[model samples]
Target: MQTILSRVLKNSTFITSIISILLGILVGAIMMIMAGYDPILAYNALFASALLQPYDLGETIRTITPLILIGLAVALAFRTGLFNIGVEGQVIVGQLVAVIIGLKLGLPPVLHAVVAIIGGGLAGALWAAVPGLLKAIRGVHEVIVSIMMNFIALNLSNVLIRRWLAQGTDSTPEIPESASIQMDFLSQLFGGARVHVGIFIALVAAFIMYYLLWKTKLGYELRAVGYNPLASEYAGMSVKRNILLSMMISGSFAGIAGAAELLGTSGYQSIQATFTGIGFDGIAVALLGANTPIGVILASILFGVLTYGGGNMQFEAGVPFEVIRVVFAAIILFVAANISGPLVNLFSKRRRDKHRARHLD
Candidate 1:
């Protein structure tokens, strides 16, 4: 454990993230003081409510489950030099497909859940393939195509759910027991906080992503293409194929995130007036985690804590939940600025100067 902690501390990205988080907290405190609130009390209440109880901790984990998957989705794209902003759309489509399969399929328990989850992922991949095709074949930018696809996915999903599954209802049918990811023992342990098998699925997905990106030939090609399409093509790599594959893989993870949410938490797809903000939230997680698999998981946990604890902070300390959001925003902004790189450079320069001075003396 100590070795792991030491390595994490030594990682420049991780150190920078810590600095950003501390600065964010400091900003939050300033805001709270300006508004006549007690920052310490509010933060204490947040932590207490989020960690001091089994239920709270369980709820935080449950919230984290899908975020971890979504974070992985975005992080994978980041590593491969793709901004898969369409993950929102991919997740929506995945949710719709998972609900349809869960409601209609009649397989055995474990098998049914597996099928539904995979079905959702497949749906997301297909949905993402459109933008991928456009980008790969037509030389169109993915950001534009993916953003447009998000609107299409939202409205198209609404239409499909209403016409095919709902047929005059406001929501799709509840997921059958066969397709539910909920585990009785886990639920019991958490006092019915709705944690499920999705966490394990998310962790496994992270491991798969890590292994695929760092340990496989295909991973090398994908990353190589992302690093320099011209060089990769000169090396006989198929840039277009890698681009399409990367988007599809990213979308698959997002879709799995959607399926996990429905199967493990919500159990049904309601008519959405808006895209679930969770997809956009993944961008922050990816940034904060430095687009690494382990970073995504750790970042998801931090986000979950802040998100779940915000309400308690509001109630106990009379601070608005929006303040917590502000802190999150601040952290993301700082991370985006790449503050850690500059800080590291400054520290290195200072060390060099000190060494030169000592040698001269």
Candidate 2:
């Protein structure tokens, strides 16, 4: 408990998030006023729409699906000091691969779903591996390479969806029933809701990631390398391999995110070239979660609420949906700029000095 409190106290990022959240609310209210809207009514309506209404609740969960998975991907790479910006590309590849497998070979329900999800993960791994390999062998910076790979994947997905896989319609073929994770079967249970089993799958993955990062030897090595690569190398750890492994795992996680969206939620075989912003949102989720699995889960839900609420704000208050983007941008900037090690050291030292004075009693 003491350690937890001390860590929280020392974390400038956490403090910054809190401050930014409050500031964002104030700024949003000002915008609401400028637009001749009542801020209080707008906020109340936003909460009601996002949480109280069934349709809004469903949309909230839908948005969260990719956020959780992609946030996990980013958090995983961060554990090994890798900034994997290729999650956007990895997600696209995963979506493509899952749809391909679902359409190509029709199998039993369980097997088909498994293959589609796994195939998506593999595609993500392959996409991420290119940058990983470059970083490992050629000493290239991963940030630049990963960003480039995102563009490549985006264009590739566009071409594949528009030309080859498209069914002469806006989207590709409908996924085989066997591979779909829609909750259509549970119509009697929830009044024909769109909520699928994919949410459970995402939660399970989060638990698995928590265990992998906290209770395993590989996790330790990954963290060691992340702390200091040169020191990790001197300690006889395979720094290069760990870097590659980190990126692959990160990419795989993001790939599964895409699969979750394609099979479990959207069910569309072909998505737009610029469909969702989950990749970018994942970065914010990672920071808010404090780079922990449990934190990520909580952060994802909070973001879901915001998104849902924002939609309500738009519908009832006449506020623009784009306002949410501005709020998020402000919060991210504050969190990114304020968090650092020196802040932790300063707080720790002050606490120790206090402890020494108390001991004299």
TM-score of each candidate structure, all chains considered together: 0.95, 0.88
- RMSD, model 1, all Cα superposed? 2.7
**Which ten contiguous residues of candidate 2 have the minimum total lDDT?**
184-193
Each model's RMSD to truth, in Å? 2.7, 3.5
Candidate 2 accuracy as lDDT: 0.82
Name the best candidate (by lDDT): 1
- What are the lDDT figures for the candidates, one per model? 0.90, 0.82
lDDT of 2 at 107: 97
* Runs in model 2 lying further than 4 Å from the true structure: 1-8, 11-16, 185-191, 271-275, 339-361
